[model samples]
Target: MFATVAFAQANDDLTINTPPSIVQCKTTMISWDGGVSPFDLVRISISLSMHNTETPNLLLSINLRAKCSVTEEGVVVEDFPNILPGSSFDFFVDFPAGATLGFTVTDNNGDKAETAPVTVQESDESTCLSD
Candidate 1:
């Protein structure tokens, strides 16, 4: 008798990095390594969510989309125009202090990455919890 096996391929070229912790209502930076060639337009899809840290139940979720340009060095993000590959892209969440925050990133070709829940710290006096 003969048996058949299956294998899945991975895109090892792409890499992602997110903050382990972030202050509530403040901008946080998330970056990723780039391997796509220059002059390509990449669709960026992002999702931000909050959950109760103690309970581990989801509380809120927000979805956002953007377009980025690929250059010889890396993808140029509109929010951070001068950034390079593995530099960073910024995001802000209005979650309350002590809430667990998480995010995901995906490109046009279905390449994606996600992070484990991170703790949200109390914001400074100048920061507002929501818009």
Candidate 2:
């Protein structure tokens, strides 16, 4: 959903404490537990799961052109979804205006990343972009 929900426990029998690792632009929180790599649960599960934009998307849903800075490179996503590849601390799943959305972020070894679900809907106007 738009928020946390319980997932099945891992073979380790430890209920994954601390919800999924969500990386919202400035509000980033990434954690790993239950012997399950964050990438496995978040990236593999959600990324592969999404069908299309019209489909009710998983988390990291709203920002058409938002920037969540996990590093100097940060995560600069545009309406056109021009995602630059690089090794970063973590990654965020973004749904741009048109076309399909995908989580294409890799880690330091240039491998894929695991992330939490995030829903971003701002009622207020943005100062980041200008007309």
Candidate 3:
């Protein structure tokens, strides 16, 4: 059927704006929301290098542990899961509270398509700690 073909075509198309390139913390938050159909599986990955070399060293690897949730307060939440295209997800990491974070995204074909960096900030510190 023509309609079925069209649907498939549309669903195959996926697009998203990469997150920041440098984040500043151990717990970095990443989010993406674009695709023709709900993403079957979405993941946030990282490639670390010490001096920004052509090939950074492999420091660590991980996948989202649950589904991402968007809160009314504009905060994106994620437990980690296989995301569907045309949908969105969010997750946080456990980097230092003030360390820079970098990451990339890959599609179904194991292709690193996009990269984003963000600066991490301290969640909140008690005034007493300042002393």
Best candidate (score: lDDT): 1
lDDT, candidate 3, 37-82, per-residue tens: 3233333323333333422223333334544332222122222334
Please give the CA lDDT of all the candidate structures: 0.46, 0.30, 0.39
Per-model TM against the reference: 0.51, 0.25, 0.41
Q: Residue 93: error of model 3 in Å?
A: 3.3
Per-candidate count of clashing residue pairs (backbone under 3 Å): 0, 5, 36
Stretches off by above 4 angstroms in model 3 are: 1-13, 19-29, 33-81, 107-112, 125-131
Per-residue lDDT value at 89 in model 3: 51
- Cα TM-score of candidate 2: 0.25
Would you list the rank order by TM-score, best first?
A: 1, 3, 2
lDDT of 2 at 32: 37
lDDT of 1 by residue, 74-121 (tens): 122222232333335676645667655454455434555555557667
Q: Which residue window of length 10 is worst by lDDT in model 1?
A: 1-10
Candidates 1 and 3: which is better by lDDT? Answer: 1
